[model samples]
Target: MFGNICTLYYTRRKLIFDFLKPGNQCRQLVPEATVDVQRRQRKMTSPDDESRSFFAQTELDSLKGKKAKLARTGTHSHVFKATMDSRGNAQVAVKLVDLRSRGEYIERFMPRELAIIPRLDHVNIVAAYAIHRTPEYVAIVEEYASGGDLLNYIRTRPERYLQEQEAKPIFRQLMDAIIYLERLHIVHRDIKCENIFLDSNLRVKLGDFGFARELRPGVDSNTHCGSRPYAAIELLSGRTYRGNGVDIWSAGVVLYVILTSYFPFGSSKDEVPAIIKRQRSQSIHFSQRLSGEVRSLILGMLHPDPKKRLYSRRILAHPWLAETPHRT
Candidate 1:
């Protein structure tokens, strides 16, 4: 019963700024020592025709005005895409926040997302290039994966499921990324097909860091923010829990969906809770497509009790992940 997922894209080309052409380039601040985005943004406080035109010219022009479908909407933030330079091919994404109202939420989300995303450097994790803070909106520029997302791939498959050969390597990469995040004490609270992107090589690139959080010693989260169908029981129960457990639970759902093109509990949104309730009390019904080993792994990960859930390292060791040697 999880809600729909959203995605965005951008790309990199050893970014080099040419401030001499200020008219051609929007403000950006790149870090010297690390990937943390540093940018010189122009803050505007008025909506005069000149202001509107200035923003219109600068905002749209910076992104090369190639807007893809907006991935998400907030009280103040709206995600969009555009070319970063004249290359037309060199793209960067931006999330424009209407700072006049509902800016507080963005203020909170921006810093935390910025803090965690840049620190991660993994083949499976998406890369962030720069952050532009303007008075009107805070735009985050990042890599663009033209291969779209995993959901589309799953949906296009026959019966909305991948063959074991197709699912193996993708699942392994996702597992590797999740395990890497777990080791760093970083939890990707949301893990679903939609949050997973594919590169030209079909390599998994985990995106969307808005719900990500770092767990300090003895700390856990109870924010209750996640897609419903893939949500962990602990999260749905409104109890504080480790980020790793929730992620593991979500990953199990992803694995099932990858192998079958639909949720194990059922696809109807309204019936998901009831199905999950039954699943918690009983066990999942296996489809003909799933192998016995695959079913077992899913059961262990989807265990109702977080304490009993199979986490990253164990999942990595699962036989299904080794059934074939692939890109993972």
Candidate 2:
């Protein structure tokens, strides 16, 4: 009886092992498991999966092409740099003028800049290359100045004093640009150090013509315009005065700052009113260290009375300027 029982147990164990194996009975019990295993195996080896895996790689080539195209051009109204084209054949600086910040001024002024700047072929002015206008954006393309602006140059080289010798040439160049504008009856109301840019070879390019206005023959502009520190006394006083005189006064202020690295008048914001009052009340002063001729020239330019201030022509012909030989 014990032998019969051991044989019966062996038979039952074999039958259970057969039932668990992959066959008709196991398939009947776990149909979904077989399908799931096959699906996973197919996913591991499928060409569709490989294609999806490499999709970004394929898209990258097209994106690189787009990036290359973007690199060739840049915007200016907002700060940006120039890029090279796909073939690397062209380079341009793009300026994006925000319609929101500028408002109606952008609509009125930008078109004028585009129409005016390209026609102006002066050596001292930055050349306008192109203008692109879209419903969403306005861009002005210009010649890229790798050397940046004069303000940055001066700030970076603080210890380097612009000696009379070095300054004379730059002054001459600036005068040429200013005189050219005057001849055209275009008054660059704003003339500050930052508005001037330099090329790689240190050639000056007067920029930012936003404040420029065409002066009709025999017409006097009484508009109060220009940076405060450089503005003439008459302009700050809200008095209608000669445009040329105002410009010359700014030039004098610029020259003074360039020479001494210090502003001649005012400190805090409240002091400006008093400074203007003083300019009207008293004669302008120069440090004792300045030469008598230089002092005389500056005072002549800064004269509170428009009639007394030196005109651009007279300034160019002044003995101080004539005596100093320009290097470049």
Which candidate wins on TM-score?
1
Q: How displaced is residue 34 in candidate 2, in Å?
A: 51
Give the per-residue lDDT digits (tens) of candidate 2, residues 1-328: 0010001111111222222222322111111111111111124358655433222122112112112112222122443344333335233344555454455457555555555565565777766644434344455555556677766766666553465556666666777777778877777777877777777888778877766777766787677766787888887888876456777887787777767776666533646688798677644566676777777778888888998888887888887787654334
TM-score of 1: 0.77
Tell me the spans in candidate 2 whose CA falls farther than 4 Å from its real position.
1-76, 85-92, 102-104, 107-112, 158-160, 267-272, 281-285, 323-328
lDDT (Cα, tens digit) per residue for candidate 1, span 128-225: 76565555555665666767789988887767778877788888888889888988999888898888988888999998888788986579778776
Question: Model 1: runs farther than 4 Å from truth?
Answer: 1-57, 60-76, 86-88, 101-107, 266-268, 271-276, 323-328
For each candidate, what is the lDDT? 0.67, 0.57
TM-scores for every candidate against the unseen true structure: 0.77, 0.69
Worst 10 residues of 1 by lDDT: 1-10
Model 2 score (lDDT): 0.57
Candidate 2 residue 132 C-alpha distance from true site, Å: 1.6
The model with the greatest lDDT is 1
